[model samples]
Target: MAVDVEAPGLTPVHRELSRAYVEWLTPQDRQPFRPHVTLMNKATVEEAKAALAELGAGWSAFDSHSPALLLWRYLGGPWESVRRFPFTGRAG
Candidate 1:
């Protein structure tokens, strides 16, 4: 689920936004952010490794767009969607 964040200004914008909530971030979150999308979680090591291998075998570069920003809150066991901020600007 590694991502190459190509969106212009995204990295800088993430840093700027993250700074405001630095006090709440964990040690891992405090480190440099490597943006990625998780396709599967809560899986066994073998299952995850197999899935990754299968996915990588058929993977190809693709272009995708972000239509909105989803704000989520981790409630211990599950994540809750707090808000959605739709991008009104023109897409690249």
Candidate 2:
């Protein structure tokens, strides 16, 4: 599932923090950064579109919120492989 930024209660701080975090990343690291929350993984494009359409139709709008920071082990060796950044959020 995709996190809708257009969700009714989104705050400007959310946008700013995302922007700042992206800006702080190196060019290569920046490539994977997109303002989204993934609810499922490894779906084909067609399946993804169908799921998204269903979600949109069901939820006319979404509640505004920021995702909490989550840490996971990188499957591909070191954390640096995924690009490192100084944490910059309340939980950090």
lDDT of 1 by residue, 7-63 (tens): 765676578768888888889778877777777768888988888899988977777
Write down the RMSD of candidate 2 (Cα, Å).
6.9
Per-candidate Cα RMSD to the true structure, in Å, reads 3.3, 6.9
**lDDT tens digits, residues 12-59, model 2?**
545555587775655755463345667667888999889888876876
Worst 10 residues of 1 by lDDT: 1-10
Give the TM-score (vs. native) of candidate 2: 0.41
Task: Give the residue spans of candidate 1 off by over 4 A.
Answer: 1-5, 90-92
Q: What's the TM for model 1?
A: 0.77
Candidate lDDT values, in order:
0.77, 0.57
- Model 2 ranges off by over 4 Å: 6-28, 64-68, 77-92
Highest lDDT against the true fold, candidate: 1
Backbone N/Cα/C clashes per model: 0, 0
